[model samples]
Target: MKYLVIGGAGFLGSHLINSLDGEITIVDDLSTVKYFEKKPGINFIRQKIENFETNEKYDYVIDLAARPSPEDYINHPVETALSNSIGTYKALEIARKSDAIFFYTSSSEIYGHAEIIPTPETYWGKVNPNGIRSCYDESKRFSEALIMSYLRQYGLDVRIQRPFNVYGPKLREDGSYGRVISRFIYQALKGEDITIFGDGNQTRAFLYVSDWVEATKKMLGKGLKGTILNIGSDKEMKIIELANTILSMTKSESKIKFLPPREDDPPRRAADISKAKKILNWEPKVNIEEGLKITIEWFKGVLN
Candidate 1:
């Protein structure tokens, strides 16, 4: 299969690229550093997704391009907005022209402060378009809307997967990019205080990268056009509990520090994966403990 993986150099993108075998072309600007080595036989192009130009036909056009780091989008909201808006348009145009199946990695952040627990694909999200996180949230929402428009207006085959708190190796462990799992692991390993932005009661369900990758491949192979699946673990954990777990796992003496909550941070986030189970016969197999153990080992290698 010929695949065009935009943002294939990022954490999740790198893992996905390594899993596939075939003619693959990757386009990334190195805005986020790639932790894995680029494999042989893969074509690499360094460019912004919005400015990317390609005429080659592809069987799959997957757009994983986006500045998902809260610090990143907050710091560079305009670029983040443009990446999903114009960048998504660019991806759609390519898929439409090549008649390739289009896949987009939409985040669970789209369901900002969801009123429902284990939010489903049907939830029309209670998102704030003007909030600090709006750049990433609204842009993803817009990208999904734009994809749907393409599906109806141009008959483009598309799959939109909303992943919740996917964490694993290669996830950046610096600044704002060091999301909860990676950040906690890094801090704990280095004997630094593990910072909790809120009261430590905010909950999140994290899916291991491998489990998410499996679901993604299933979604692609199923070729379900116009399908929106929530690919995430239904298991949940509190922020405080997560910190404690990481500390114990890493055997570090990092104290847990609670700070003022970040504005627009979701209090609770999980996924209702019934749709994924029924449609793709898929559900996350990695429990939090197991996933954390594997992830901690990877962080150790990176640190050492």
Candidate 2:
């Protein structure tokens, strides 16, 4: 099927683009983007989704476009919200018009600090609307609503996956956008101090890129009509424990230091992925350690 990947130039998007077979179109602007290089063979469109006017459409549209980093959003909240809300709406509109399958990438950030350990899709989030990171969390919440509305009103084929802590190759060093996994991996490889934000008790389930993509692609082809399934590993770890695991694995000389946690930092997060597994029949294959080894080598090449 013909596919269009929004924001296909960056890290996660690039990997997703690479994994696709058959004809694919990429919509992105490489302006001020400092991570992955512009890939080959992708039909790259150089325009912001806001100003973007495409005569083309697709059989499937995967919306991976968003300013994902909390730090980036803090500085540019307006653009952050706009990118997510408007960009997702446009993608949904295209899907509705084309009668295409639409997959929307939401986040575990939508779960915020969960009142529960492993957050089920039904668990209402604990996000602060007034918090500094609200730009992303709330914007994605708005995006979810918008996409679901299309699914209800127009019966546009739609599925939403909320990925947790996805990390792999082509990571950007811009600090805000990359996950804790990429940040720690890069710092350890660079012989730099590993900074753990806060006292390090905050937890997240880290899903390797391959595992994430595998789960995602499977769910995108299923009976989950207008459903929100989280695509992530069920493995859980604290910030400090995760840091130590990396240090132990790499045998690096980098010191693990502490910083005060940022606002809206979740106390703990994990996916109660029973839905994705039972429904989609997909589970994460790569364990954390194996995933880290692969990621570390990728960073070594780029940093060297």
Candidate 3:
């Protein structure tokens, strides 16, 4: 099988590429990645998905290009919006022509401040269209709509996967753009203040990257077209508890610093993975503590 992977140089894409056994081509501008070592026996194109032009045919077209970091999207909203809206269109066009199965990696952030505890794919979501995080949230929502339209109108084989708070090795930990787990681990390792926004009661369900990659490969391998799956761990965790865990694991002497709540930050976020379990017959295997231990070791290697 042949595959075209957009944004295949980032954290999730890098791991996904390692699991594939076929001719592969990765097209990415490297805007969100800091350091990605190119793998052998694959074609790499250094360009944005929106502007990339390709006539090659493939069996699969996977679009994972987007600025997901709250800090980065909030800072560069226009780029984020275009990456999903226009970028998704370009990927769809490629899949349409190549007659390939298309897979889009959407986010759980589409459910902004969700009223439901474990959000299912049936939920329409209550996202803010004009908020600070809308660039990332609304754009993902729009991309899902666009992908559905392509499936309905053009008979394109398409699949959508919404992933909750995924983190592990190769996750960005350089600065403010890092997600909660990466940021906390980096702070703990550096002996800096572990900052918590709001009252530290906000909760999130995190899936380790390896488990996520396993589910993704299964979805692409066996999932039918027009199917949407929510891939994540159901285990929920509080921010304060997460901070304490990281501090304890790293044995760092960093105090917890409380800050004002972030704009449009969700009070609680978790996934209802019943559909994924029934359809893909998969569930996350790694618990939070074990996942964190491995992640911390990866960060320590980078530090050394």
TM-scores for all candidates: the values are: 0.98, 0.95, 0.98
lDDT by residue for model 1 (1-304), tens:
9999999999889999888878999999988775857788999999998999988999999999988888778999999999999999999999999999999999999999899898899999998999999999999999999999999999999999998889999999898667889999999999999999989999999899999889989989855999999999777789999999999989999999998898999999989999999999998888899999999999999898
Candidate with top lDDT is 3
Worst 10 residues of 2 by lDDT: 30-39
Lowest summed lDDT over 10 consecutive residues: which window, candidate 1? Answer: 31-40
lDDT of 3 by residue, 153-242 (tens): 999999999999999999997765688899999999999999999999999999999999999998887548899999997778999999
Error of 2 at 55 (Å): 2.3
lDDT of 2 at 188: 80
Worst 10 residues of 3 by lDDT: 171-180
What Cα-based lDDT does every candidate model obtain? Answer: 0.91, 0.81, 0.93
Per-residue C-alpha lDDT of model 2 across residues 208-259, encoded as one tens digit per residue:
8888878777866756678789888777898888888888887889998888
Residue 238, model 2: Cα distance from true site in angstroms: 0.9
